[model samples]
Target: MELSELTIHKAHELLKQKKISSLELTMALLERIDACDEKIGAYISIAGEKAIDQAKIADEAIAKGNISPLTGIPVSIKDLICTKGIRTTCASKMLENFVPFYDAFVIKKLKKENAVILGKVNMDEFAMGSSTENSSIKITHNPWDLSRIPGGSSGGSAASVAADLCLASLGSDTGGSIRQPASHCGVVGIKPTYGRVSRFGLIAFASSLDQIGPLTKDVTDSAIMMNAVSGYDRNDSTSVSVDVPDYTSFCKKGLNGLRVGIPKEFHSYKGLDPEVDLAVKNAVKTLEDLGALSVEISLPHTEYTVAAYYVIAPAEASSNLARYDGVKYGFRDMDKKTLIEMYKGTRSQGFGDEVKRRIILGTYVLSAGYYDAYYRKASQVRALITEDFKKAFKKCDVILSPVAPTPAFTIGEKADDPLTMYLSDIFTLSANLAGIPGMSLPCGFSKSGLPIGLQIMGMHFNEEKIFKTAFNFEQATEFHNKKPMR
Candidate 1:
């Protein structure tokens, strides 16, 4: 197998046997990025020199018989995550040139394990849009079909892994950013339960809704990444103080007694493509054949999920994004005559239309008179949504559904209609709103050859169940083994 295409586990085995050096593997991936990234537009920046230096350090450690799963593995990080001495642009002009002096908690963990950072990948501006076309820097096209979007705001993260530009990538999910893109790009992506991963140094989009997770070539790589990045961190107050299991150990076969819940609402939803519905239904039968039981379940408040998420996410985004005024770091308007004028001018020139739209919606929802009408009601509905998941979990171990309504759509299909774009994430928004773990892996392909994703959601911190189920399904099918011809 080509070095760049090796999974994390496979590469580590070869490195352990001294068949390959960290420098050699890192160079292979860097070369792959160099050759293909122009067409993929996966990276916002590439840390070639620094990555080589890190790979050398990993080689020294490996020579001394010390290594980790991620040691010397070339990885890409979504631009929203901060890295010390690396420019972490959230694909917005406001912080296009901003460089952080401190690394995010996840980056610190990856660095400690000696993972070679291939640098930042692109995303929607401030992670506010469903399609990567909202990115101010560059539009990331789907590797499957260059005419379609790779999904967003983690489009680059998913595309990078799908195209083998990087072995794996870290992507933050807010209202389905990670899973949706992974679904569209035909790769494995997981969003752990809220607080399962630390959020410090993650550029805030919706503080309450955002959670960082990995997008990889398969479920095993996802587990390897989970093992490396999951755990408590004092830097983030929301970081849950709990034991993180070795996620890799749970990538086992046989779902003998596992109960898979199928929400009727999702399958019956309007606008769902027939191919995606049939794919997910077939996946359910596959699980049944594997000795699993499929139970028809209902997340009763499912219809309110999108509305509630839009209100709550935007409200939090408004509060969290208030610090980006020109007075502080990031882009500034030097020609403004007054402080207020400067703030307005800088933000006006900095943020993109999608970001400005969310900020406006957020500010409006949080306004004095409107707070009780919109934000407060949304919060109440959010609680109901969370409770619905809790109740559904009582009937089954994990919930299974389609990740999106359809496979990747054309680049400009929904760009002009914001509501249509928002609905693209309907199946995924509930998981984020309820703060549960969710994942997407390739299930099948549409007639036109676009990939479809099967979403598996676990209650709270039960990511092990998600990993196990996805791994089992992946092994039973050949979808995960297929790659887009680049």
Candidate 2:
């Protein structure tokens, strides 16, 4: 079988049964990259030597009768997550040469499980854009349609998985980063409840909103990866102490009697295309066909979420990115004579326009005089959004909606208008603000040949139920089997 065509579960089964060696799988994937990556540009770097070494060790471990489900399974890590001693640039020029000394909580987990790290995938600079075109280093085109985008921040990871460059990949979501890309690439990506996955060593875009999750070809693969990575980390100040459930056991549970809600307010948001609405409505019907009951619910404060995210995310980013001054970290423009001049010069030169724009905007909003007006108002709005979700969850196990307002747009479609691009996240951002798990999967496709995804929002720490629901729908529907026109 082609490396790209194999699901993570299938790969694991083959490895366990000795049908294929871990080394062989690693080599086949590497050869595929050699054949196709230049044109697709899905990866920023390919850790071939390390992946091969890791695969050999995995084979040796299995030979010794020591094994785990993830052992030898290959994964592409998103560029935003820190990998010890590796160039962990967050797809930004400021950290192009920055190498972290410690592994992120997720990276540590993957290593502990013996998963082979293929390399870091590209992303939007500081995760600010919806399209991968905002990547500081290079533009990543959709494998399904080269003229269009693969969605972003986690765009490279989504593209890699969808195009079969790797079995699965790690993607971080701040607002809609992971799930949006998953929607565009026609794969599965879940944004776990905030603090559910440790943020320690993940480059902060919006500290409170950022979350690490898995992007896989199927819900089962995502469940396996989630079980391997989700946990409490002492190193992460915000990490929750709640016990992470065994995702595999509950994933196969049928969705009979499950109560799913369709947010009436979110479904009516502007910019939603007619085709997307039809696809999502059809997906809801499929859930009903699978024995789940669906009802209309309301997230009353939906309007305030976008207003709050823009402010709160930037405020947190400004504070978190403060450490990037020339003297201690990030790029250093040593040409300046004075220390302060050096800081300004390096930041101005190193950061892309989007990063610079956010930093400045964030700094301004959080400034001594303006905090109450912009930052404080946004914080208050955040509370309202959370309260709204609390009320809605009382009525349903999860909320179902469109992952994005529209299907994958052409490459340059949303690039020029920052505000327009930001609106793309309108549907998925509320889950993050409320600290809930959200996921996107192929519900169906549009007539133009692009994919359509349904967004699923689950209650806090209820990831098992989320996957159970996803897995059930996945088994019942034929949508998951449709591949992009690659």
Candidate 3:
């Protein structure tokens, strides 16, 4: 196997055994990115020299017997996470030249573990779209089928991992950004329970719904990445004071005594692709055969997920993104003389169409005349959605569903229709809305050979359960082992 394709655990084993040095592994990945990233368009910035320097330091640490699972691993980062001295664009022209003075909480954790960061990958501009074509920077193509979208907001993160450009990546999930893309790209992506991982440095789209997580080649790697980054943070008010468990320990647990919930509403949803439906049903049967109890459950409010999410997410985004006027650190229109003109001109020129559309919708919803009619009602629906998940969890240990309604569609297929694009995240928005842990991993493939993802969600702070379930299924199937042809 190519060194660039090695999982974090495997690479750590080789590094600790002196079979390979961090420099060699890092270089192998850099070479892979150099050779393949052009066609994939997975990266917005490449930090080759910095990664080499970090790898050298990691090798020295390994020699001193200070190695961890990620000590010598190479990984990619979503561009929205702030990295000190590295340009953090958020895939928007607004912050194209912006560099952070400090690292995000997750980046600090990764650095402490001596992980080498290859570069910042692309995303939907301000995380406002379902397809990466919304990126003002570049269009990240699916490695499985170059003509199709990899999926969005975290498209580049998933694409890089699937294409072996990087072993794993860090991505933020707000309304299914992480899992949908992971499904489209055929990789493992986890969104820990809200406040499980610190969001201190993440560029916020919807502060209440955003959670930082990992995208990896397999389930074990996902656990390793989660272990390094999950913990209470004094810097973030929303971060809960909870003990972080050893996620890796749960990976070996079999499916015996596990209860998996299948939501009736999801299976009966209109427009679900037959291929995806078959794959998920087969996955449920496979779980049953492995001694897991499959129970039909109801999250009756599931039908309202898409409508509720759009209103709540955009409302939060409107308030959070208001800081990007001309006076801040990002782009400013100096050509305008009046202050208001500068503010208007900067935002008009800086943000992309999707971003502007969301901002306008958000602002309108939050206005005095409409707040009671839109944002307030959405908040009520959000509470109901959370209640729905709470009720469903009482009946099962974990919930299983398709990550997306269909396999990845070709780029531009739904770009002109924002409502259709929002529906792409129907299966995933509930987890984020309820602030619970969720994951996406390969279950099967579409008839056209595109990948299909199976989602496993657990109660808040119960990532161990999700990991145990995902690992068992991954062991039984070869879906995750299949790589995209470059």
lDDT of each: 0.93, 0.88, 0.93
The 10 consecutive residues of candidate 2 with the worst lDDT sum are 477-486
Compose the digit string of candidate 1's lDDT tens values, residues 189-211.
99999999999999999988899
**Candidate 3 local lDDT, 344-374, one digit each (tens):** 9999999999999999999989998999988
Model 3 compared with the native: what TM-score? Answer: 0.99
TM agreement with the true structure for every prediction = 0.99, 0.98, 0.99
Ten residues in sequence with the least summed lDDT for candidate 3: 125-134
In model 3, state the lDDT of residue 72. Answer: 79
Stretches of candidate 2 off by over 4 Å are none
After best superposition, candidate 1 residue 119: deviation in angstroms? 1.2
